[model samples]
Target: MSYQDRRSPDPLRRRRRTTPRQRALLELLKRDNHFRSAQQWHAELRTTVGVGLTSVYRILHQFAEQHVVETQRAEDGELLYRLRDTAEHYHNLLCRICGRAERFTLDALEHHTEHVARQYRYADVNHHLDLYGTCPDCAGVAQQE
Candidate 1:
């Protein structure tokens, strides 16, 4: 099938109008508490907002494109989606063993990022760094065991 055929029918495709379902999806993503799968989000919509799966996907894609939510692929290759914090900067540390994630910021790392970008002659550089190691709690648990 063609790409247009794959997409849902849009009568007001020319006009950008936010439906109630879209608003609910945006609000749900803005809460920023837990990671949710598409299926889980669909169930929540059914119980709470009465939106369909197709609408959920469409709204989610819109939100992701607009930076309303952030999407990441987990170590197991699952596409996980989370709400984006507009006010806070985001960086992640990953536990290579347990696939756990932590957030942190360091002024030294920020300076290094800028320095490397400048040295490499990169323009408009934005970077993401994911440090991989066992977390302190995990290391302690391993030692105790």
Candidate 2:
């Protein structure tokens, strides 16, 4: 039998199946909160899910648009992504050693941002902030040695 005929003849059946690439991507992101580049994620996914680099990039972009993932810019300007902990605007306090993250918001910063935007007549202002330190567990481990 030909490839098409050999497979499920029902097109709807195939369409109903979840996109494995997307599912795999979400699972990976959910496992960690560290901001990482698409290539960093793709490297891990490639080993387990065989997802392509381009596909990973595309999926991440879609997640960003949907607000399913938070996006940040790396020091070099490459966009990084992490699974968002909140539906509202937030920032992160990141554990440098373990990559754990705690979500937070600064009302003063938010107000200032808005005030500056209004002063300049800019619309739709947005911001990002991340704080990093060695987490308690990691620090304790170091002390024991």
Q: Report lDDT per candidate.
A: 0.61, 0.70
The best candidate in terms of lDDT? 2
RMSD of each: 9.9, 11.6
| lDDT digits (tens) for residues 6-113 of candidate 2 | 222332223334488988888889897777889899988888997789999998888765556767655455777887545456666766554556667789988998
Question: What TM-score would each prediction reach against the true structure?
Answer: 0.58, 0.67
Candidate 2: residue 66 lDDT (0-100): 56
Error of 1 at 97 (Å): 13
Q: Candidate 1 — what's its lDDT? A: 0.61
Q: Using alpha carbons, what is the TM-score of model 2?
A: 0.67
Clashes of 2: 0
Instruction: Please estimate how well model 2 matches the true structure, expressed as its whole-model Cα lDDT.
Output: 0.70
